[model samples]
Target: MRRNTGVFIAFAIVFCWFALLTFLLQFPTVFTEPWPYILLLLQTHLYTGLFITAHDAMHGVAAPGNIKLNTVIGFVCALLFAFNWYPRLLPKHHQHHHFVATEKDPDYHGGNFWAWYLSFLKQYITWPQMLAMALTFNILTYFFPLENVVLYWMLPAVLATFQLFYFGTYQPHKGEHNAENKHRSTTLKRNHVWAFISCYFFGYHYEHHDKPFLPWWKLYQEKDRSFK
Candidate 1:
């Protein structure tokens, strides 16, 4: 089987980044200073990255030709982000691709943003997972500063759900873009910085539908391609 070097690099980078953020959050001075808030924001993006990495695995591109490795990577990433059920996510995500923005799509929502977000949460959030997360939070806070645990570990995962919804799901598939694109998705106009910041260029939603195999880091290259 051919090696997916890029996927390996992307996974390594995200894992190392998560580790770095954990280290900074654990440090006494960093936890006490104003930097923890900024780190929390950065960690939110990293959490988004982990989700996207798992997403890439779902498409079989993250660790191409190595199903076991891909599954392990996706499961670990999702688990770290407080989502424990990768098996449940995998099939539902495939259904979303097949019936995108329609009633059949697990993520589909034709109404208000909050309502849609609530629906999305309802489908995935489980009682056991919440209890596990709460228990884990209690244990962590016993060892680390409560502020550090809340800001660095808890808040980012919560904010990342919003980030994923707003940038990846709601913004690209809402209103005008939905009407114009057959897939009910549209690409964000070229803006490299924001492109990278917002869901790793998943703002380029149409391009993603066209080439689902492309990894998140390479999605921006589609901006230059003539879709005609």
Candidate 2:
């Protein structure tokens, strides 16, 4: 099947799943006790899926010759989590793709297990200039009152989740010579399954790295092709 076709199939499945979950959340009996927490978690998970889809769009992996469409999709997806719609960040993310596994890459893996663990914190907190970012997030949340959650709280939380997800997947594939490489290689069996089910198969990072232009659904096909 074509990459785009696969992506559409994957997207349809994910959308349906989220829709079902949302429907279930509306029933007090279905969600049972602690409905608020359940709803929040479900919403956050759905938002993460949207965020990954937006990332794909930003990379032009979701659409062709339609930059505006990609921008609009990405911006709308970010808004679901109360994030800023900064088009400039797309270029920086693209740059990471170019350098993939190297230290010279700002997004490199950068150390051993412990080091990488610590680095994840730094990536999510420090590099973004946490205090200033927190203030900005707060300001944004204060202005927007979607989902009853303060905009500031939601923005930072969602952005932090994205950062952690990115680092967890990217770091494993980074080069040994890279500043963040504490190990020669990393495994993704656990993460991949969870990401596939939770983050809309975005944990298939190795496959994505191999065929950057291929849509998400065809990512697995590309992985299979390498063995063939």
Tens digit of per-residue lDDT, candidate 2, span 67-121: 7765666665554433434464477567667765556555555576556555544
Collision pairs in model 1: none
Q: Give the clashing pairs for model 2.
A: 110-180, 111-180, 111-181, 111-182, 112-182, 141-151, 141-152
TM-score of each: 0.91, 0.60
lDDT top scorer: 1
Computed on alpha carbons, the lDDT of every model, listed in order, comes to 0.80, 0.53
lDDT tens digits, residue span 8-85, model 1 = 765685776678667855866554568767777788888888888888888877888878888888888777778558
Model 1: lDDT of residue 223: 73
Query: What lDDT is reached at residue 82 by model 1?
Result: 84
RMSD of every prediction: 2.4, 6.3
Off by over 4 Å in 2: 1-37, 109-156, 159-171, 174-187, 190-195, 226-228
